[model samples]
Target: MKLQKGWKLLSSAALAVVLALTGCSQTAAPTQPGTEATTGQTPQDDGGQADMTAMLRLNLKTEPPSLDPPKGFDTTSNEVLNATMEGLARLDKDHKPQPAMAEKWTVSEDGKTYTFTLRDSKWSNGDPVTAQDFEFAFKRILDPNNAFPSAFLAYYIAGAEEYNTGKGNADAVLVKAFDDKTLEVKLNAPAGFFTHILTQPTFFPVNKKVVESNSKWAENASSIVTNGPFKMEDWVHDQSIKIVKNDGYWDKDSVKLAGINWFMVNDENTQYQMYKTGQLDKVSSVPNDMKKQLIDSGEAKVDSDASIYYYRMNTKMPPFNNVNIRKAFALAIDRQSLIDNVVQGKQTRALAHVPYGFPEPAGGDFREKGGDYLKDNDIEQAKELLKKGMEEEGWTTLPLVTMTYNTSDGHKAIAQVLQEMYKKNLGIEIKLESKEWKVFLSDQRARNLQFSRSTIPADYGDPINYLELYVTDHPGNRINYSNKEYDALVEKIRNTADETERFKLMHDAEKIFMDDMPLVPIYFATKIFMDQPNVNGIVRHPVGTTDYKWAEVRKK
Candidate 1:
């Protein structure tokens, strides 16, 4: 969904005011362990377990695809790999931009250039992480042959587009190493949210020597290097991956946990069972049946995430090419009912393109700003649109369509709800297909699967992070949706330095998308999990990395 030009300006101004009031310098650093108090005792000492070492076990749905920071973007991989790699910037409890490996930075007045002063950090292999490492990592990911799905993060960098297109030398890009500790980047245009973008792993510096020396680097557990709070110790693909605290980490003294064991369990039933048996620390996307059990046991804790689960129609296909049909499909489903019944009221219904609390912009109601385009449950209107679409296109029978989802019970239940809704409300038949999570992800990226389930995590704390996914030519635009007007607005927001003007443009662009119904809004995710009571300092950030850095485990 696009934001209106006027709203974009107002939103930007609002953000600026909020940032100023909050005192941007007070932003917390990414997860760091508890440090000693000025009183000469560490925080962990209060519990009389100053030397205690705890092992936290996690149950994951799938193994990470890769440990290489530059190549890992998928949620499964990101959750695990993020603990091992340090980015130039980190997302704090509020998902605000903060320092990480880079101690501080300066942005030019034109907003097209950023110079960062790096902290003296060493890789797990004892090699110094220099500014050149970042330059090399950035250029390599932009290589067209690499087919990095996240190349768009660097598109703002000067010469990045040419480098990614194979039209210019990779070294010609804006990133440069002034020395071992200083790095500079030149952007093609002003990008207001560029600092937040740097928090992504794609921009994280890597040890060039380590990656080049190992031919199978990042492919397996042993071939990777760690620069963050933890180091991967063992990885049995599709089974479990283990990590231990990194003593070599710069702030090792603050790290309290000794180890973490991540188990890969695809079945929700098995995961729930593990948690019940006290073998797992946390499990997300709990099943309907298990929710009551966890709640009764006082183990259920629900956290609302700033993510949207939606179904994208392949606009490039024949039947879906018509916008009316797309709107009809959108209007047919009852989003509120879906949230209440299918999701068991665990999630909130999405009305606007931007999910609430994202970037937590001040003084603007996104729902009101969405205008009248937001689709609500109206079976009669949907049928009318569908009838007109079929008549205009010379079609009488509904097309045979397949709705795909992951092999989890929750997804299976959701797909069934959609299938029943489409058939009963619109007389449209939709076959349900479920595949393994990895296969489903692959199919989505290739655009080979139609009408599939997808979720977008907030990259930064901004609405634009989610909005940009729908931009024309975006790698994540799996539905092949392209609107020239929307594309133009996105470009304008990126280049426009005026904060007020940028937000207005984005808000207007969002209205156009909500009106088009290129995607069927499902519900905002509600993550339910249970953690030990001793897990303190584990603040839940709605966006970005979900890890424990500032947290310390104290004995009860």
Candidate 2:
């Protein structure tokens, strides 16, 4: 079944979905907790009393690059935005879209238009959230000068791409505010995962009045006003941030935690120590050496992450510019060993470039259907490919290649392992470089690294979400990979409405992508965290942010 309204999800190794199509129907309204089968999350039943003064203390890992929703491109900023804002729709525990700011929405007969009736909601600053807010926000995302990384998403909205690319007038973009409460949108084509993607950070509405008054409204807590369950209380740049529960929230009763104290701690060992000493309620990063012990002792929890942990080979750079060299380097790594000995049970060897949790029309896992791409330990083939690649480049010695990773204990471990693997398999020595998170992201976006360790989490639930990353010069395509045929294939997939045909095209596209070998597939990431038993109800979606809306820290 195609992704649509009234869909029921059945989980297998990945996902199984049954949904309705060919209809103009009003989506189900959001129900209060305990009223629906999946209401995002349920508090853990450890027989502990609920803490009256509830606050979750966790590490954000790094300073968020931006608090402005459209510019909050990194995961650190994504988490902060997820807690501080609300979008038209929010994903339930089952990964199904539920009414959020919009009380209900209706789709057009052709599935290319959507009309949303927003519920009565107020910002922390006491302004009423209106449809005009959404209208302004959508256009702000598509403004060519803004260059928001997520602008491509709004391209589905009729004329949005034209405006974003400076080829059309902004007034012609098919997003409009019919009134104070009603918003309408027209799409160039049907996008089945539209609602799913709406849960992303960039889709959240911004306060136009506040922004107009202060261009840097999102720069500090004093100027920011949020419509979500929480609002920023304080931000001490690069140190810590404190968000307090928004008293004016429309659904304040459902929000359990009083606030979240987000600390910026880069080292896993320090984070784990903080957790052990009760300075933190939950810690997502811990020393790699302690992962298995913690998991085995039931001190930590491991959840599947719908993300790919891989190395991006700059296709425009030397050595990797040769397809054979790219494949050779990709196939040299022992991914299973990396997972088993280093990352522990926190990850599994990725079977394909697409991580998991997407279901095909015939109810099979997308990964299972596509099969594995590169042989992880193909040493002889890797050596041969390296020789041929060097020959093709007319070089007696390979170019100076460096593997770069963001500074982290686990990342350092993985880089060391890969370095040894390359030396053992391809008889090549490569340099390793580490940078701070912010610097790393900046340099990577600039395509400054030759080979870089990278992890990509799905922006939405769908097979195409992963495949669309390599589209010609996409902002997300940091590796600078460009292939006209692959770009055309993605275009065909985007325009296609049929489930079987789309999946078939996606498979073909993946084959082409793997054959080109722009990036090396390492493993599918897993969320490994140690939480104090009393800290419960935090809903961490496989694709999106770790939600604090339904969370509570119980009294011991």
The best candidate in terms of TM-score? 2
Poorly placed runs, candidate 1 (over 4 Å): 1-52, 292-298, 359-362, 365-368
lDDT per residue, candidate 2, 533-552, as tens digits?
Answer: 78777777777777888888
Please provide, for model 1 over 417-530, each residue's C-alpha lDDT reduced to its tens digit, 9 standing for 90 to 100. 677678777888888899888778778888887677888877765677777888886878888889989888887777776666666777888887877778887766655666
TM-score of 2: 0.91
Per-prediction TM-score, please?
0.87, 0.91
For each candidate, what is the lDDT? 0.71, 0.81
- Model 1: number of clashes? 26
Give the distance in Å from residue 345's predicted Cα in candidate 2 to where it truly belongs. 2.4
TM-score of 1: 0.87
